[model samples]
Target: MSPAHVLEPTYDTLRRRLLMGAWPAGQRLEAARLAADLGVSITPVRDSLNRLTGERLIVSQPGDGFHVPRLDEAGLRGLLDWHHAIVTMALGRERAGRPDEFQLTGGDLPERSAHLFASLVARARDEELDWAIENAAARLGRFRHHEAAVLAEADKDVGAIERMMDEADSPGLRAAIDYHHDRRRSAVDQLIAASRGGQII
Candidate 1:
């Protein structure tokens, strides 16, 4: 088998760890240590780190090495704002021809939330736009994992969205989306505060 094929599993494993907040933000990811921990060679770890850098989960510097991204209030706000704009555009298209009812499957709250957004984005009928939103959503998922309060509150937001979907209330749906973004912004603020206070290690 090709070396890249052999390393695919290791890459996936590391990606999951990064998304699940296994490492604190700003922590340097040493390839040697990660390979030792994962029982793999450094090659796969390096490859994974480079891939994650492209995804914006981690960044590499000439001398600083690879590290999980750290967001200040402004940076966090910018990310959230970007997410908001893309999702709003998607929702607008969804509202244009919204159905009378909607459905949500059972499972993890975050996964369900993702399904809600994906469903709306799918309505846009633009594959490239959907791809861009999904890509950004994946990157933002890491930030969501960094704050427990955000995840807990996301359940309520998801339910609100579900209700809006069932009623096909476009205005209500927009309002719910706004509320969700507000909560996420607050969560980012709290994370910044905690980090400054040395509470987040």
Candidate 2:
């Protein structure tokens, strides 16, 4: 709606479109056109895009307008490394000896692992998710650009990413991190191959 929220409906709309790969990387986006496309005025769109730019999901050239931020292998690895460190520090056995070690809370990951992951994936398709605990996964554009790559390359170890979050072995967790990368690389590779052939995976 209006620009009051500055980052809600407008931001969400853009993030989802990006996650769906609706636009190619480096394609410039004009706020007015995007506003028209979203059926709203340019104000909200500008504000929303500003927020994404702050998150490094969009880039603003000196005079070339705004475009989706493209990620290289280095950028991808940086994000994955953050995931590994955060997950390990927050839930690692060495740190707190596992959140599971403490018996409480109303969460049911062990019982509803598949359902939760599925829901997360669906939400991902519709919008962005923070993938952090305290934040409870708010929609943010940071991960959308990498979704296709993560999914395609990550197929071989989908189960393991879930396992790393659920299991508490230090070594296993470490392996799961690498496995996560291999899977994403696989997914990205497939997407790239398809792209080269003028198709999508």
- State the displacement of the C-alpha of residue 52, model 1, in Å, after optimal TM-score superposition: 1.0
Query: For every model shown, what is its TM-score relative to the native structure?
Result: 0.82, 0.61
Model 2 per-residue lDDT at 78: 55
lDDT of 2 by residue, 21-40 (tens): 56665568899999888888
Runs in model 1 lying further than 4 Å from the true structure: 95-107, 146-153, 166-169, 193-201
Q: What's each prediction's clash count? A: 0, 7
Instruction: Choose the strongest candidate by TM-score.
Output: 1
The superposed Cα distance between candidate 2 and the true structure at residue 183, in angstroms, equals 3.9
TM-score, candidate 2, is 0.61
